[model samples]
Target: MAELRLMKGNEAIAEAAIRCGCDGYFGYPITPQSEVLETLMARMPWDETGMVVLQAESELAAINMVYGGAGCGKKVMTSSSSPGISLKQEGITYIAGAELPCLVVNVVRGGPGLGTIQPAQSDYFQAVKGGGHGDYKLIVLAPASVQEMYDFVDLGFELAFKYRNPAMILSDGVIGQMMEKVQLGDYKPRLTNEEIIKRYGSWATTGKTADRKRNIITSLDLDAGSQEKFNIKLQNKYKEIQDKEVRFEKIACDDAEYLLVAYGSSSRVCQKAIDIARGKGIKVGLLRPITLFPYPSKAIQELLPQLKGILSVEMSAGQMVEDVRLAVNGKVNVEHFGRMGGVIPTPNEVVEALEEKFIKA
Candidate 1:
């Protein structure tokens, strides 16, 4: 039987990680997401499931710890807010270059610099466009609700291991702090050392056996030619993910004349806006991207013919609008509507923007 509970999104993430057989968690506390580490510490999964949960001195140290654990074929994760996430980028790039599997959760707060502790979707570009210095991408999942907060932890780990790349749950302060009902999934046991060796010994840094060669996990190749080859390999993997991993949800798109493209908390606001627009007979719909990295570009492109315009709604100053425009390719008018620095726009405000930008225009 599934366990049903009312919990905050950040707490759900922590509980889900333990239930999903996560091997370890290393993170430093940050606003809007501190509950993740707190919950983990409170539960002490280390005593129950033998999962290693540690709070590092800084976000930098935490991400590096995740990198070290992931190299050993263990399911590891870390969590942070915008500024803290910035500190993890270097380690994230290294983890990607090493082709190690791990999960990262960023409960976004307002930013540019320590801007605010409130919710915002300002980090879309950083999450999807590789914030770190490298030719790499993390499989980014944006969860809009507390239910999804629980669901994506398991899915994120699955995708991470499948691609041997990092997977991130890009959430925001609203979802992190808001309490909601969640139906927890069945518990999955952590894989044993022998199981890890059997499944990932080819690349993971498991101890060498006489029957096989030693495995190495690294992101360095001094040879230019070899480095280029590695880059090409990473590019190919990204392409494969783009083809196979795009996820999205469409609401009232079939008969809509205008579209709204959004994700995370903005998507929830857009949903309400959709209702408002429909009530006013505006025929507006929403397309919510679930996977931000392998974005639903193809889906957006296919919906272009039926739509007269698109409004890329966000909680940032129009970051994702660029991607929507790139996908639309000027087939129709596309505009952006947003409120920045932790201020969330109301449904009426989004509807007004849609009216001004698409309906009235």
Candidate 2:
């Protein structure tokens, strides 16, 4: 039976990692998400499941460790807040270049450089648009609830290994610190070395054996032509992921004249605003994006015919609004309303923004 517990979103991430048989977690302590490392420390999963949990000296070190672990076909992950996530970008790009599978969690805080430790969706572009570099995409998953925070940890790794790409759980402070009753999955055992060799030996840096060719893991090639070909291969993989993995939720969209587009914590706020708007006959619906990279562009385009305009509610000044606008392609007016520096907009505020930007306009 699955265990039921009241767990903070960050804690749920840690607990779920252990339950899902994560091979290792390497990260530095940072606010809004520091609890992820802390929970792992207190639990000592090394004692329970032999999972390696290490707090590296810095965010840079932690991400490199993830790169090494991933090359070896291990299920490794790292967690951090916004600034810390920025520090990991170089290594992230390297891991992507090598096509190593790993998971990253960013429980975001306000930021432009060590900004407030308050919740914010400011990292949307960084998360979805490839924070590292090159033509690569992190299989980005946005969790709107504590339950999703728990569920996505496992799902993120699955997708990562499925495509041999890095994945990210783009969470924010509001969800990280919030407490909720969560039903956790049953425990899964860590894969043994033989199983790892059997499964990922095709690409992972297992060992050079006579019976099979050696596996070399890297993102570098001396010839520019070779590099271009590799880049094209990566692009093809990204297209496949985009086609097969777009996930989102639509609420009250039927017969709606306007839509609210948001993700992560902002999506939760919009859900409340939708009810209040519907009560007043505003006919506002919500399109909550679950996967940020495989963005629900088609989903938004499908609703363009019904939507009068879109009021994008976010915790940042405006990040995701660009994507929403691009999805609508001027078929409808798209407006943005948000608060920065950790300010979370109230449900009433969202309704008012909708009224001002779409309904009243």
Q: What is the C-alpha RMSD of each candidate to the true structure, in Å?
A: 0.8, 0.9
lDDT of 1 by residue, 1-361 (tens): 7789999999999999999999999999899899999999999999889999999999999999999999999999999999999999999999999999999999999988989999999999899999999889999999999999999999999999999999999999999999999999988999999999999988888888898989888999999999999999999999999999999999999999999999998999999999998999999889999999898999999988899999999999999999999999889999999999999999999999999987777
Q: Which 10-residue window of candidate 1 scores lowest in summed lDDT? A: 352-361
How high is the CA lDDT of each candidate model?
0.95, 0.94
lDDT of 2 at 32: 86
197 in model 1: Cα distance from truth in Å? 0.5
> In candidate 2, where is summed lDDT lowest over 10 consecutive residues?
352-361
Cα lDDT of model 2 overall?
A: 0.94
Question: Clashing residue pairs in candidate 2, if any?
Answer: none
For model 1, the local distance difference test gives: 0.95
lDDT at residue 185 of model 1 (Cα atoms): 92
